[model samples]
Target: MSAAIFHNPLLNNGPDPWIVKQSDGFYYMMVTAGRHLALRRSRTITGLADEEPKVIWAPSSPGPYSHNLWAPELHEIDGTKYIYYTANDGGGDDTRRVCVLQLSGTDPMQDEWIFKGAVNAEHPGLDGTVLPHKGELYFFYSGYGHFPDYGSAIYAARMANPWTLVGPNVLITAPTADWEKQGGMAINEGPAFLRRFGRIFLIFSASATWSDDYCLGLTSISESADLLDASAWDKHPGPVFAQYPEHGVYAPGHNSFTISPDGQEDWIVYHAYDYSEVDQKRSESRPRSTRVQRFGWTDKGMPDFAKPMALDTPLNRPSGEV
Candidate 1:
């Protein structure tokens, strides 16, 4: 039989999409569910939308981590599953911080998710992600800091464990470029690690997510370099991925990377608006749906995300789909 086809906007109401294909030969996905963390599993990359999302974790009462849950990412370390996400105490943006959850039991859907508490307690931020290298763990997130302007900037700290951040947090990248300061905010958030050709690439979202100008930025450091050292990273001057107005795609940001089912292809899962319908009433809570498309690596050892595709475009499914 011929391989099945897929389209953009895999889900109509998913933002900050995070997906991981595990050794069990299944793809698990998690996105921003506002008040709780949810999980979906499927055999194919495009099948995640068809799976019923299981509420793996939800707050029992209003507290520090009881409101504004966003960007939930699932990662496994030493045979245990942990989720790193953003949450707040139902206050303003300053209360937003990265929190973690630990899993008990074999399956995520049937397991109990225990709160592990906030990371980097002194520093309030959002969008926490993990990068493991050479038997060490590094945690990256968008922390509330001033880069000559009061807004969020990318920060990194060494992880003592899945939920604890050790040492001082180092500033990685800031919103200095003109493109990074759009929609009345200067921002550099959503840091995701992509490793290729023995180098670690830091891909992050820039500008305000609610703005049509929201896009993706890039930076990198050699695998052997000290990840916590801010000087060791080389920041890209321009966005590596941005809106494709001709294709009717807008504000693509907060991305995660996963391999094809057969582990032969690289795919990017991100969230974007279907069209430019900006209004005075717009906010981050606006429905930004999830999308996925295969990306290619450059001969010079870099990622080429190309341009965002239109929602109606029919594309071949990921290679080796079951």
Candidate 2:
């Protein structure tokens, strides 16, 4: 089995794209469609864009989950598929909160997805995601106690179940470094987990997405230790993955992990803007596109994302995929 090497910008444009390869040997993916929730079905990762995405859910009225939906993560827990996303009215940040939508069946594309309500602990935030690690369910997201100065930082809390967070949120990381304070704003968001190389690392997007300086950061935790304690995490001092202007890729952030078809190789799928989109970002009319690349590890057991390659460059296919 061999897989093809796909180019950058897997799709035309979307925010917070995620793909889940299920036991049925198909990939179920969904992106923030703004006005509605649509999912694409593909047998191969490269086939995602060409598939006719199905619209599974949408906001019925002008209330809580009405507009500004951002960073929705789809997961299967206890044989049920669920989606976690940030939503708010057209009002402002104060109204922003994380919400969940649960599917009636195992398959996300065919079953009816019902609104599970807000998952945040009565706060303002977005990009909510949950994972079951070491027999415990934990929710990780970017949020704040107060806006304007509270800014957006990474937070983690224990969850009693998929649709609920059970305790006070712990601040994991915020925009403290100079690189994180780009475009006159400091933000740490889009937290994604990678449990490998003898540690559990939190890989999140840093800085404002609109800025060319937007990049990725890394924080690690011991697999045997308590994840609820904020002090147990170790954030890397700098960006793990960032823009490569010479390659024409900028603002590479908001990433998710997957494996090659044979399940022997690790891959990363993320959204990044090209140099051409930087100017258009002023009005935000143009959108960032998702890209896929194979990443490796250093001798130190850390992930080496290398540089963001140009879209025109050719890359080798993932090993053992066909």
Which pairs clash (backbone N, Cα, C closer than 3 Å) in model 1?
none
Please estimate how well model 2 matches the true structure, expressed as its whole-model Cα lDDT: 0.81
Off by more than 4 A, model 1: 1-3, 146-148, 277-286
Clashes of each: 0, 5
Q: Per-residue lDDT tens digits of candidate 1, residues 1-322?
A: 3448777788988999999987667899999999988999999999998999998888899998899999999998888888999999999878898998998866877878888889964568899998888898888899887445848998888889988878888989999999999888999999988888888999999999878989999999998899888999999999999988899888999999999887899999999987684654345555899999999988888999999999988888998986
* lDDT by residue for model 2 (1-322), tens: 2245556677868667787777778777777778777888877777786798788878989997799877777887777778888888988877888888998877778888999889856458888888788778889888865656536898889998888888888888878888897766788988888887678988998888877888999999888878877888898999999998899888888888877777877778888877643464444556788888889888988888999888887766656545
Evaluated at residue 16, the lDDT of candidate 2 is 76
